[model samples]
Target: MLPPSVFESAFNSSPIGKYLLSPTPEALILAVNDAFLKACSRRREDLLGKSLFVAFPADPDDPASSTNEAELRASFARVLETGTPDLLPVQRYPIPLEGPDGTIAFEERFWSAYSAPVFGPDGAVTCISHTTKDVTEQIRSERALRESENRFRALTTAGQVVYRMNADWTELRELDGRGFLRDTDSPRSFWLQDYIPDDEQARVHAAVGEAIRTGRVFELEHRVRRIDGSDGWALSRAVPICDAHGRVVEWIGAASDITERKAAEEKLRESDRRKDEFLAMLAHELRNPIAPISAAAALLQRMQLDEALVRRTSQIIARQVGHMTALIDDLLDVSRVTRGLVELERVPLDLRDVLQDAVEQVAPLVQARRHTLALELPSQATIVVGDKKRLVQVVANLLNNAAKYTPEGGCLAVRAGAQDGGACVEVSDNGIGMAPELTGRVFDLFAQAERSADRSLGGLGLGLALVKSLVELHGGTVGCESAGLGQGSRFLACLPCLSGDTAPQGEQDDEPMAQAPAALRVLVVDDNVDAAVMLAMLLEASGHEVLVEHGARAALARAHEARPQVFLLDIGLPEMDGKELARRLRAEPATRDALLVAVTGYGQDSDREQIMAAGFDHHLVKPVDMERLEAILAGAA
Candidate 1:
């Protein structure tokens, strides 16, 4: 043991706060070292004769002080009762201090304290020795670290893929994929090659290099290998974890699976691009016919020509008008079919008759192209339950498409036979074929091969779409195949076949000979003066007395005066619309029994329903087929 004087000096100079307390129920303070006095910011007289509770009171205003005081008191009592040493937990104790205004205040502090009992010669407790050290900063640091850990765990649980890597990104230390990718618990040296796609690895490397060079946050959206071994998109971001000198030691990062979002964005972009392309194509196609018609009209008006010249100009106008009408009809047909408006009139039909009709329909085009047309059919008639007209249209459209795409004099073949319990018709052409990509989307609406400025292949890209839709409507399928560009193409159509010869009833062998319409008083009504005059002139040429009027009221007056037996009315009138005009005409006594025909540009199924409901007997779409109109007139007469 040291001398008494040296021990006193050592006790006073010790860094830790030490104090002695009386071993009584009150626990009064008997003595305090210099360190204990300085730690509490008190003078020796303030604590020497005071109880431990009196010198350091638990502040009622501070909730942290309440429980720690009870705990410290229990610890002191235990040490004295057992005559042994005891340790106290970290405590939130408030110390009293003197302010400049001679007022007393409490300063919040934390401490770790220990208590031990002193023994007398009889082995009984006499005094309790107490020691303390300030530990406020250490506790605060621990709390901050725990909070950081909690936040990191929350992020990993909430669908964020967490990862840690070396500063150079050459090795991955750990990863939790959160189910977006595969997890890696051990260090991986080839993480870049394992996670990122081969095509995207270089891009990721560049981003990593930039981030490392500048010690900045790294961010990239690139393709990655998913758990299923498929390439998917991910948005990865990482920030450098630096040392005290701002040198990057490692990188901590997160990634999110963005595969679905990226796919949706790409689809939207493609749709927008297709919409713009379709609109441009529409404008181009419309202008093609309009240009010729406009020129033909100018020629007729500006030049006084001979009979041959006049006839040629009229034919040019008629031809372009017919082309325009065909284009409009195609548009209407596709619209009705796509919207499920067109209902097929199904009947048992022989495939031979359909093929014959289709061939006849395309014979003119075949002849024009000077191509050798080969048609192969089964020895016996192949029967199918389908709409005859629609089937004929399907085959005719395929032939016409082949003709249009094939070079002049190129070979075209149509082969039909029984296959796989159904009938298959393949139309193959030795002409300019399509690329592999085009073959897949050949039947999509507005999908077309690249055309020249002249658009030598004149079509609205609707034929194949119509063919596919019509085939599907009849419970059939259509597909296209091509070797590649310039290698020609083949289109195949499959339809369900019927077993027995169940020919449709009332099937005519041939149409009855057409009769000439008897001369009758006819009144033609139209909003367009030109249309009215043209129809009237044509009717007069057919040996009928024809009267023309531009509107509904005038047509009604003319009908009453002339006692016309037939009335051809345009559906779009000025004051009264065509449907209303037709109703009024039927209500009138003079023309109520007259034949009412709807002649207009509106040709949808709904338009026909409205026209027929309004007392019209017949509906004709314009630039109407005069042969069909004449046949209707002859039948009515």
Candidate 2:
């Protein structure tokens, strides 16, 4: 038996827990700290210095008891020889035994068992020092905490936004796909690995140096790595997270996907530039008609009363005004087509009927030029789903082109029938045919075929292009063909046919359009004298009492004299545009009740809204028409 002081020394050296030991031959003896022994039903005097098999006893017949007895004896002998402890698989178990008071008191305990050999002063094996550590709840808690951390890490790394950073941007630490603490060969890394070109690496390195110097943010946009492994533009912003002493610690950043936004902005800018070019071309085009119309109107306005000459010059002014209106309408159509904002009113339209109306409208022009128009439309209806008014415009443009391009006595043929399982229409003219190269670009905006040097060809190239857009919008296509220059040109249109052919009544069934009251006193104002008079003349012929002014000051002077019911003012003037002039006019009681109308080439929808808000009641695009003018005057609103 060990002395009390020696036992105290061993107990103090060891933590407060249960322990196990084996005697030299074969015996199960356990040593426990006072803290552990207090929970036992066995008396302290009985526990110490007693045979451990008596203190904490087990059944000799049980498998656990016999197996543990053999293992303890074997391990003790081996530790004595080798001077090392041995671990056992069974970490926890209860030793069933008797207690003090000579009563059968059950002792229930959990422990981690350990066995090491003890030596005497002669260095001979005396016993195996053994221990049992009570740690039933601690191991379970650590395992649960480890599991929770692993799950959280997995969730974070799975997201695209989460990333690990190196103190320097030179290298990156990759995150697993699940964000867990495991790695694969293809882990998620930073964008620096790609995107930057080989030549541009030096530049980026210099930029990194600057960022490190000032500890400021690095802002840049460049083509960078994408998740798909392809390259795209990235808007990257990185900022240095500094230490307490103001030294740079680490840099962190976010890269946003800006590829689509950049592309869309470029497209919008291109569209705006095209519009500016078109407007400039429009101004140049309007000058052509304004000059001739102004010259003719000025000559007629100065003439005295000769009924024959008066009538003849009036016809010239009228013809020129019509030509100008056609051109202006074409420009408006181009804007509408380019923006993809044209809405179609789908009514069942018969192609033959539309072609006939177009043919009749061009009959007078064809007659004067002595060009023969041949019609080859099928008698039956060639049904289509379309807007009737737009269809009329399309056919009118084709027929007009046929008549205008064909020389006097040349044949212009129109054929509408079924072809290629769809409704096909062909317009052919025996005129100076176009070159192959010209045919390719014929439908481009502002494109025109060069005629003889006199340059008398009237139409802009906007019509065919507009028609092509309109046709495609309705799921149709159009193309032009020619047998080389000077032979002829043929234009064919193929439109999808309507479902089952029971059609509605023709447009003659809806002919009675609105008719307002008679024309009111209307004022026409412009910077150009001829434009103002010709507009005035057009309205006058349409049955309104018309007044004309050359400029804004003159217009303000005449506003009271005319007591106009409506003012058609141009926006471009020397002193001010018609919009500002209209504001001043609206302030005057003389023209207070009069409806102000703006007539300018700046006819974009947004521009029109601006003029209207500036006190104008109506807006008209430049180059007037007699019929539309009559409609406006009659309504006078």
Candidate 3:
């Protein structure tokens, strides 16, 4: 109802972008608002009296520009024809801009536009008024939000529960509607006690409360009851959501099942505990032997006693040293078996002979304990293919175990027979038997039965473990049984027996000890003065010329001077180790052919291999047996 002049003035001064076009086929532009001129980056003189398409035509080189321009033109034409307003969806329409280099460039833009026809006195359409608003930023924001939601859904779809709770943590629900709460009866109200196990409810509740109070992320691992009435472990984490005023409003959280991982963690903890116990036990057993040896050495150093007292003290020292040596041997044997380094020497042998030898080795212990021994061996020899020495060690270990565990004067029995084409050896004794639980793990490494208060029966707990490993190496099996505590215990070892005639036995030596051959010049090298001097004295007493050196350098210098027929070298020496010294000696022409023998504390198969590789003819562990050394010397001669 306004006048044309007033309406024109209002339309030209509007804040929004607006333009007036003549209702003709050419659609000539008549006027434009200040906002439209600025938006288009043009002047009214450049657009007035020109067709709308001429003023802002599609780019000739742009393929999409024609479609965009056509859509806008159709919208304007519809408004002029129908005399009704037309609203257009958001669309891309590039505008021209002048670059810093004075070149015209197209700038991309998105806009929402509306067009309405203006009528004259006769109600005929005269002009079209168009209004536009730029909406590029709003569209970009909506696209980003949609992408974020898609990513969140992808993550939660794989066995994870995404949930949200009220500010007080009462109204909890699954945001994705994935039925994660179906097990909880889809409760409208949620609490830690409803999902977590009774034992962990309090802890989880306290953590959630703290997170709400401090507005921090809450993370916890606890056991939960699943919908199927089964228990499982779950790791849950949540972050508090706050309002603009920094007030806690709600929390968003996720939970993942971790049952298998938790079980593995428990197993690792148990293994660590067992290892710790084994280390402590090892330390205790080693110290037991060391204490006695140390005391005896200190005693003999300060006092010169009668021959009888000196002999007794020396025996004590020998026994303790032997005990320590056995412990070290067991430790090395276990290491070899674990690494698959041990190999069996299978030879057809008489089981009776093996049993007799084992019995002889354990006779002294049985006598010392005053325990009665009974043997039931088959009159006909039971032949089996096995390593004679290792079999003897196995039987001896079992006999010794029985003697050690049985009280003084207890009864012991050994039964050997052929059954089901296999040979079996059974050793039983009325000892302080083990409990059922103890029997199950009796053969485990570092496993031992309860000991007395004074610990009179002492061992490293490796005897049965070694027995089992050795028996198995020979294609045999070993088992132990006990009725109960204080009843009795029995061990059985079974091996496949030979069906045919046994292998020919070597010639037996029933005569007296052979006289030693003529003594040779021998050189002894060692780092311990006491050990070196004692060995030298022993060789001298055996009618051999001996020279001793405590250092490898001194020994090397002496060996070249003496050109001795035999060289006894210690592996661990200062400045030059025995391996290198041996290499040097073997390289020297003077001592190249000398009988090189390694005499040190090391006795492992690998140690022997190293010594032989270093050019030693023989390797002997420390505290060498006199008879074994005598035989080696005689062989060399």
Candidate 4:
């Protein structure tokens, strides 16, 4: 053994932290090496001769320090009693330091310690030697690594595949060893060949090549094949890992499933295409009726005709005008239904009465087609809560559809009964039945079956759609069934039944004639000269004083001169619109009290409300019915 002075010098200079505690109940610190003094951030003079626990007490502010102090004291007591070394687990033992402000502060630390007994010549424990190693940085690094692994596991569980690849795009491997790709053995050059669909291979390859060449982020959406041999959509993104010299060394990437999102995008595109087709069809249908009306007007003006020819030509004009009006009305009805603006007038009524009216309305078409018609009504009346007019229209549309599609002598049947706690009406026809696929979508707006070049079975494909909307608004449902093309077709409408008293009897009246009222002053104002002239002629022929004006200024001048009792104005005027003209006229005493009627093609509910708000008493849409006009005249008189 070396001399005491030499041993003390060697102990103080040792690199490993060492401290000696006197073999006493208090475990007083006798001496400490320079390494131990540095480890605790203290001077030897401050620690020597003080109790070990008292000199470095457990930090009351740190909960972990108490556990560490207890474990350390147990190891020291065991070493002193048995004269053997006792090792302790790594522990968080914070040391106290005097700050520049003279306040005691704790320096957080983790330590690996071993306590050994130093025996004296008498074979008794004289002192306890404790050795320590500071391992704070190592412990912190291990904790961070554990957290990273947990995050990686979570991402894998969420269906995200993490991949690593060479910077040159020549090799690839899934980081988690989960075979997300179908062909795990394939190289980078052929990686997408087996996974991605053939149609998307070129685009995805190009994107990958560009990203590698420019060291930019790679992003692509492509189709992938699953283990079950099914196809799905995936979105892949990757970033380049570069070396210190800014040279690409590796790439990390992830891919997520996006099949549902892609499907939604495709559906939206299909809807847009269908909307475009419907708009084109609408334009074509409108032109068909306008062409004949234009030619008839030109013929009447250019030629002298016999009375029979004149009457025939007039009838043609009337029929075409009616057709145009029906088309416009259907368009408006669809707009109203789609906007949730259609309000139904619900009333308790007999389903049989509605069926009777609908059958009568379509009798002309049924007779023209020469179809054999059969009617089946229940033994008892079926009562339902519904809108009477709308229910009638729904059944009438179904009957008309049957007549239009059936051959010259096909069979048609309409049945009304009670079923499933509801009143049901069904119309079936042995005509050009629809295909199985079309049965499901026949009631879709603008959905039409195959038609001939002449479009002889003319329609805007809005009838069934309107029926469906109206029926649903009445708290009912409509459905169609077909056996296949040319076999037959059937439509059924069901409305919730109501148990109540009998429906009120409807009034029966003879058709009223368009009789002239006692003569009264009338003014017709329209932007179209022909419309103004035609209206004026009709009013004059009815024995009323009539004047025509083609513009707002002209109509204002005419009203001032004539002081007309009735002022008919178009809503779309040149400099000032009809609403403005009506406003100006209402401000004037001469026309304020006159019966103001707005005549225009704009007939939406909002348009009518606007015109009425502008001081008009009535609003009549274009191609106004003669009977309605006659009634208005009589009412005014």
Query: lDDT by residue for model 4 over 1-637, one digit each (tens)?
Result: 7779998998889998988888887889898999988777676656889998899898989888898888887888788767789998888889888653357888888889988888889998888888888888788656654553344322233355778888877777766435554556654553566666788888888998899889999988887765556787766788999999999998898776666556867977967876776777778788988898888888798666888878888888898889888988988888877555656666678888888899999999999889998989787768887667878999999999888888989999999988898889999999989888888888887676243234667777788888888888777899999998888899999988876465744644534455557788998888899888888898888898998888889889888999999888988888788999999999998889988888899887657877899999888899877677777777778
Residue-wise C-alpha lDDT for candidate 3, range 157-199, written one tens digit per residue: 3355678887888888786535556543453878666677799
Runs in model 3 lying further than 4 Å from the true structure:
1-197, 224-233, 241-268, 302-304, 349-353, 374-384, 415-425, 449-454, 475-478, 492-518
Go through the candidates in order and give the C-alpha RMSD of each one to the true structure.
32.7, 35.8, 31.2, 30.7
Q: lDDT, candidate 3, residue 223? A: 80
State TM-scores per candidate: 0.66, 0.46, 0.65, 0.67
Overall local distance difference test of candidate 1: 0.81
Q: Higher TM-score: candidate 2 or 3?
A: 3
lDDT of 2 by residue, 448-492 (tens): 523322336656668788878878877888889998888989998
Q: 61-111 in candidate 1: lDDT tens per residue?
A: 777776877888889879977778999878778877755334667887889
Candidate 1 lDDT for residue 267: 80
RMSD of model 2 against the true structure = 35.8
Better of 2 and 4 by TM-score: 4
